[model samples]
Each structure stands twice: as structure tokens, then as C-alpha cells.
Target: MPSTEAPTTHDLQATARRVRRDIIRMTAAAQSGHPAGSLSCTDLLVAVYFGGILRHDPANPFWPERDRFVFSKGHATPAYYAVLAEAGYFPTDELLTFRTLGSRLQGHTVMGNPPGVEMSAGALGMGLSFSLGLALAARMDRAPHRVYCMLSDGDCNEGQTWEAAMASAHHRVDNLTAIVDYNHIQNDGFSDYTRYSGDGDRDRVGGWVLDSGYTVKGAHPGAGRGGPQGAGRLMVRAKGLDSSLRSE
Candidate 1:
């Protein structure tokens, strides 16, 4: 194992800023990309890559024992690619090739086109299933690796998301972790999937619905609704795995 340890939250926060700046520059160059979604998840990505929470190595992208990160919320490639580049998965300059023809970086993520992208994300909700497969494989192989998939609130609109959730829960896939990025706003303007506590459904973000969109309490909400009201109540629940956060 490498002797490197995780960076402090402060340093990770700094790296996140650079990642955000990269998102701004990359999206501007692409001229057609999701900036809001990408910007919203910058710190979360940094927390994983540089926070030392995840075990991975950009130098050895295919290392079997390395942790896996599936960018399920692939539209956020600006942030994802920026993280990968900063993580040393590829050269930072390659980021400039974001969406041009023949460029490895597509508008959405493609597995083989880039060293860090684990799955080819095009549709809204396939990441959970794909990640479940990796987690199951790791279990069967007894490999000490974890697979983390990023999901989005928009993904909940798809039935496949539920199917994958059921499957993950059934198999007890502990190695898999899903993070949802519920910005309360999707391409369609606003996401109406809200969690109802006792009083009723909140029409706005609150509780666990953090400003950054990550669930506060626990990751159960396949729906990714938090009350901004606080992460404790009014949440979506995706059972099993390391819990569900916002979409990738």
C-alpha cells in the first residue's frame, strides 16, 4: 500500500475550490453542459478523492483492489473529470477536450474513454445497478474494495432506480454506496419528490435536504429528499449498502 494518508478537511476544501473553478472553465468551453449540478457536488467529490475516505489510485486506474467510483450522475462530468484530473487519473490539460468531437470526455461519462469513469452513463438511472454488480463481485472475490455510485434526485423519476434499489437491499451489498445530488432542481426546473414527516410534504428544500443536496442523517432516501428542514426528517430511503446520499 502507498504510504500516503488522507488530507485534512481544510486542504480538501481548497482542492474542491479548484475543482469548482475547473468546472466553470470546462463548462464554458463545452458551451453546453450542466454547471449547476456539477458545481453543487464539487466538495463531495473532493471529500472522497482527497478526504482519504475512499481507497483509490489514479496512477493505477485498473488496480483490482482499488475502490471504485461510478459517476452515475454522469451529467456532472465537469466536476467528476476535474476530480479525476486532480487525482492524477489523467492530465489536467486533457480536461480542455471535454466535449469536442473525438474527445475522450463526452457530454456524459463513458467507461473506456477515460481512466476514471467506471460506467458509461447516458440514461438517468443505471448507476445503482451497475455499482451493485461491482459490489457483489467484490464480495464474492473477497476483495477489500468498495464501490460508490453517485445518483441524482432526477434519477428517482426512473423505475430502474427503484429496481436497482430493491436488488441492492436484497443482496445486502455492503461494499456499494450511493450518493444522491438532490439540488431540488433538475433540468425540468424543480423536483417535486418530497419527504413527508408528520405535518406534511415540504414544497421547498429543508432538513436533511442540505443546501449542497446531500442527505444529513442516513442514506436511505432513494428519493434524496431532505427537509433542508434538516436531514433527520423528511427523507428518501434506499435500504442496504453504505446508505444513499444524493445522486452522483
Candidate 2:
């Protein structure tokens, strides 16, 4: 389903600065959170929570019929919290207490810990399944809300990720949308070298995505139709294929 409300925009970079400041303060205070990935993924979160298609009211986070957002990129909690705070889900000042005992904001987002957190994500590739469940549940109940999941570069390498993607397509879950932040880096090494076969080899197995009934739009348009950028970022949705990819 398309956005029921018109999408809005902001000085995404400026908004990102505020989110980044909170990310910095959060990780700096905790002295134990992942910072690099947090920072790199902050811009995307800023765009989503502050500028893009997320239909949320920070004041009434759990508004029974609200669009759901999931940080499948769990380690980036600092940035996620910063966005939530900026959106008024919680006080920005509370960010400093991140990861402390009893703090709602943990290193990874835990369900029920934060006002708007949809999942307790920390392990890689699991969020897709979580988000899928939410979307499918909404479908069964015929709810109007949509589910958005943000994933990381490394997550694309996970078997579970692809499994969820395939299942999502098979189920015809039209309310689900998966956004990938391809900063080109995952734990231990660059994702291009570590995960994919490089040169778009994953395109073949991705046929399963199409076979499952997805329209199949990707950064690398699959099977010799690679875009100007290599394959890193992929956003697969329920209705059709729409890609905005990046280089290796």
C-alpha cells in the first residue's frame, strides 16, 4: 500500500547532526556501544523517522493502529534512540542513560523497553522474521498499518534474511517493506568481499525471490542486469520491485 499521508522532508543532514550528537553522547556515556555502525546508519534513521514515510506519532507511540518501525540493525541503538527521542517518543536527555541498569534504551533495542520499539533485536538477520510477523498479523486482522524494517549490509549475507524475504514474497504480505543500509561494511570485513560472491552471483538464488512471486527490484537488477552501482543496498517490498543500490 502507498503512503496514506503525503511524505515530508527536512534538512536531513541537520536532523542527522542532532541524532548523531545523541548517538555520540549515548555511546560515550555507556562506553560500551557500537559507534561506527551507529554513526554510519544514523543518516538513514534520521531520514526515516524525521523525513521519510514513517507514519508515527511520538506522543502516542502505541496508537493501536500505527505504522510499525523495526531496527533490524540492532547494534545501531544509539542512532535509533536518537531518532526516537527526536521524534518525541522519549526525552532526549534520557539518552545519556543508555545501557545502564534498568534503562529503557539498551545497546540493542528490546521490545517493551522503549516506547516505540517493535522488537528485541541484537542478533543478525532475525529482525526480518520479526517484522514479517508483524506485517502478516496486520494482514490477517486487515489492519491499515504498514511495517518498515531497516537492515544492515551484513544482514544481507544471512540465510535467515533471504529466507524471510522469500517467505514474505510467498505470503503476499503487501504491507511489508525492507530497507537496507549498505555502508559496505559489516563486522570483520567489507560485505562485498565477505558476504556475496561479488559480481552479482547472488542474482541466481534471488530467483527464488521472484519465484516466490516478488517483482524483484534490486540495486543489482539480477542476472546480468546489474546497475551502475554493484549490489549492496536492496529494498524489497510486497507489491513490486523498486531498487536504489550502491557500489561495492
Candidate 3:
């Protein structure tokens, strides 16, 4: 049985900081990676891994009853591996093998390589759909697990994201929570300025969620307040994105 006593928030924060440090170091070691995105997501990853929200056993990655987390933005492998190591999924030493040939820790996330990772990600906009399917299956089996998906704002432009948004809402997979790391920067430059220009607009990303019938909640106010620099932050939490599986 899982321990009923959760780790203290202070410990969680420490773990997240260590993870952030590791992200920089590992990415530097690998000589290539999305350090910005990884740093942005460290906090959320720590919260989920240490906050008692996920059902997982590092010793048993394929445990059927475990909760699922999909790193849709797979470039953030450094952040993910850090969390997995802290959670005991694999030896912390294995992190040094990242991005090397024959190492399980590829630039992107892959299942069956290391324990704790639920899916192979990094293609963008696909993790949510995959998570939606997992949530649906859990519901059918009368299980009480949840699916959490992490996304990138830059990737939100993908049409498939909106399509999956509609499908998740249509099926009412309330047990699934999708978090957007609204970093505002992409590989080329600032995402908002590049895509929509810097107007005094509400989160166009959040607007999409609301339009799709999900209850929207912001983690903070202002630009870049909810992304990687907001390290270890909770930007937003939505409910009823899946109305078919109502929570209340």
C-alpha cells in the first residue's frame, strides 16, 4: 500500500529545485535540449510526483492501477527524468546517461525504457489524446485513477490539440487534467509576439480551453508567470473538460 503520509511541501520544493539544477546540467552534458521548457515545468512535475496526486510504484512501472502522466512536450526529458529519479523510478545515477547512444534516456520520453514514464512523447499535441483514451478505459473498468497531461504553449497551435480538446470534452473525461506550460517562447522566438502579437488579450490558450467547455482557472496573473521561470508553479486547474465523467 502507498504511504498515507505525504512528503512535506518543503521537501517537494527542494526536489523541484534539484530537478531544475539537474535539467541545466544534464542538458549541458547532452550538448542539446530544451532547457527553457524543462525548467518551466519542474515545479508541476514535482507537485505531481510528490504531492500524492499520482498513483505509481517506481518498482513497478507497468502497474495497471497506477495513475498516468503524459509528457506531451517531450523535449522536457531532463525535468521528467529528475522527477522519476526522485520518485525512485530508477537510480539517480542513470541520469548521467542521458542522450548518449544506447542510453534509455533519449532526447524525448519513451515508455518501457525507464519506469514511471507512462507514454512516449515529444511529438506535441498527442499526449492529451492518449491520456483521454487511458482515462476512458479506466472509467470503463470502474477504476478511480486519473490522467494528467503536460503541454507546451508553442505546441497549442497544432490543430490536433483543438481536436483532442473537443473529443476529451465530448466524452467527459473529468479524471483527466491538462496543464499548459505557457512559457510564451518557442524555438525561434516569443510565441505570443510571433503568433498573435503582444496585445492586451486574455490567454488565447485559456480561451481555447474555455471554448471547449472546460472550466478555466489561471495559476497567476501576467505574462510568463505560469511557465518555466515560474518554476514549480501551478498555473491553472480546469474541471469539467470531460463533462461525461462529472466529478460532482
lDDT of 2: 0.65
**Between candidates 1 and 2, the TM-score winner:** 1
For candidate 1, write residues 1-248 as lDDT tens digits: 53267465457667877998999999899888999889776766776677655677777778778888887887888999999899888899999899999899999989966886889996888987888788788878998777777777777667887687667666655566566655566887866573323222432322222122332222224222212221222122222211332222
Arranged by lDDT with the best first, the candidates are: 1, 3, 2
- Tell me how many clashing residue pairs each candidate has: 27, 0, 7
Better of 1 and 3 by lDDT: 1
Full-model lDDT, candidate 3: 0.67
Candidate 1 regions off by >4 Å? 1-3, 194-248
Worst 10 residues of 2 by lDDT: 239-248
Candidate 1 steric clashes: 27
- lDDT tens digits by residue: candidate 3, 1-248: 44445776567667777998888889889999889888776766776677666667777778787778888888889999988987888888888789999999999988867877778887877887787788789879998776777778755767777777777666655566666666676788865521332232333533222212212111123212122221121123222222321232
Off by over 4 Å in 3: 193-248
What local distance difference test score does each model get?
Answer: 0.67, 0.65, 0.67
**All candidates in order of TM-score, best leading:** 1, 3, 2
